[model samples]
Target: MTNYDFVIELFIRVDDAMKNMPKHSQAKLYPSELVTLGLLYAIKGVGERAFFRWADRDLRPLFPGLPERTRFFRLLATHQDWTERFLAEPTVLGIIDSYGIELLHPVREREKTLVREREKTLVREREKTLAPRIATKGKSNYRWIMGAKYGFLLNQLGLIVDWASSWIGTRPRKAITIPSSNP
Candidate 1:
């Protein structure tokens, strides 16, 4: 079917979904029309002005009550509660993904000890800063610099629900206790 036809179908579906809902008395557009436009905005996946233009140009015949550009968006914002009933249930499934960021490269970054040695005068004072979290296992010839690992949790719709960063967790330190000679 053509694009206009699809819009009409979408409106009908929204209308059917919200059949029990009542429209506000002073509202210019019907409840169904407003909800359809809102859904269209999301489905069209365009900026506000562009989406409005698409509707005003192509779907004006279907929605003659379409208001001014900014007003239409305002109405959509205010009347968003109407679409809640029609929205699908949030998916139970979610996805988690993580990535590593190399904040300090060995070539460009200096070790804490090296920095202290370079400035001998500063050696008497304790180092105030920490080294970058080190990364140990890469096949590349370049020495791996310290980095952080970041993770995101996304819902079924690919919306980010939460995220976290390992600010100092990637440091490579293993346990190795040495026996005292006196003992």
Candidate 2:
């Protein structure tokens, strides 16, 4: 199908699904409109400012009442639950995986320590914040790193089913759970 046809079909499906959801009387944008914008944003994979600009210029005809950036973001945040549910529809097969998200480079640790020492007088009265106390040392297949872990569940089509993150030292079993749809 053409891109226009696909978008129309997607909007129809999303609108029908969201029809039974709760609504805010003061909301200027309908759930369908919000979801459509969200899908467009995700597909475009652009930052919020750029997406807003594109929508303002190209999609204004389709979304005549598009709000300003701040209001648009607030609307998205308010309707996040609906969008999440719509995106997480079940699939035939799924995969779960995780990897480390390094917050700081090991080489930078020494520099950080030196900086902290220089600023000791300024932060003397405050608590002594240490890296070990904050981030745990963890090992990945490739290398050892000190950082947090990010986990995700993806469907057969590679869409994110769910995702989470935890401290580096935490095990995936304890940090993440895949909810059973059976009951």
Candidate 3:
């Protein structure tokens, strides 16, 4: 189907879903308009700035009420749940999978030279700011690495049913103890 056709279909579906839901407080853009832009964002898979630029140039005619970049993003975030419900398909069986997303190279974590200095500096800065909440040392494939793990649940049709990511849990250190000769 053409892009305009897809946008129209998506807008209609989301608009129908929104009919049963409460209206947004003081929203200038309709839910249909927001969902259309959201579908465009997902299909384009481009960065926010690029998406905004393209939309302004090409999509303004179709979505004349499209807001500024930041405002558009805010609207998306505010209605994220509605968007998810609108996009998700019905499924009976789902396959779950997970993978580690390494933030730093395992070898680089041990390196103490200028070659690794920049990465180290960045990690240090991130730790100071986002620490255990976002990044942590965790095991992946029996190897310790600094990173986060992402999990996904997919339906038989290979569509994602759900997804999440979080800081990896740190492994517990083995305690050292001396043998007691008296015992």
Candidate 4:
């Protein structure tokens, strides 16, 4: 099964766990749907704007019944108490390795001119605001200096149980960690 399929299953499991929990009735998106969509966005390594742009065409199949991005993000932000349970779970032996998911502009693409420009603008803005002040020198063969890092905390099974992004620095700052676990 694709990673999205597994994540869909994970969301169902989390929803089942929260079945008896107290929640507001006015909430537009379910906790499971919010987590699922966020994971999907992270997995696709695209921003919400991009996701929404292609949601009808590309992501609808994966989501089946996806909600609007505003609703999805609102649920995620306003209902953290419910979602935090997922991130705190460790699906593995106690440690999960993290990686960076740097979204780069395609070196050979002419379509989606507006999207590319917006992504580039955002990246440049992030570079200005988020890049590390201190610089370290290294001369390895793959001497890379990523300005920021973004990736999921997946188990050995390749399931994303968490997601994090960090600024590149001697003392890297932790990014927001998304919940990706069970109760």
Considering every candidate listed, which one attains the maximal lDDT? 2
* Poorly placed runs, candidate 3 (over 4 Å): 87-92, 107-134, 141-147, 170-183
lDDT digits (tens) for residues 64-154 of candidate 4: 6566777666665675555556654445443445444323323323344466577997767766865454233322224344344555666
**What is the lDDT of every predicted structure here?**
0.70, 0.77, 0.72, 0.56
Task: Tell me the deviation in Å of residue 24 in model 4.
Answer: 2.0
Task: Give stretches of model 4 more than 4 Å off.
Answer: 1-11, 53-71, 77-84, 87-144, 150-164, 170-183
Q: What TM-score would you give candidate 4 relative to the actual structure?
A: 0.45
Give lDDT tens digits, candidate 2, residues 85-118. 7656547678889888887776776787788698
lDDT of 3: 0.72
lDDT of each residue in 33-119, candidate 3, tens digit only: 787788779889999999999889987887887888999999898887666564345366667777888888767755634644668
- lDDT, candidate 1, 1-183, per-residue tens: 999889889988888888887877887788899988898899999999899888899989999989999999889888866764743333467676766666666564456558868887775543433223244333222435456656666668986555565543443233222223362
**lDDT at 56 for candidate 1?**
91
Clashing pairs counted in every model? 1, 0, 0, 2
Inter-residue clash pairs, candidate 1:
133-146
Q: In candidate 2, where is summed lDDT lowest over 10 consecutive residues?
A: 123-132
TM-score per candidate, chains pooled: 0.50, 0.64, 0.65, 0.45
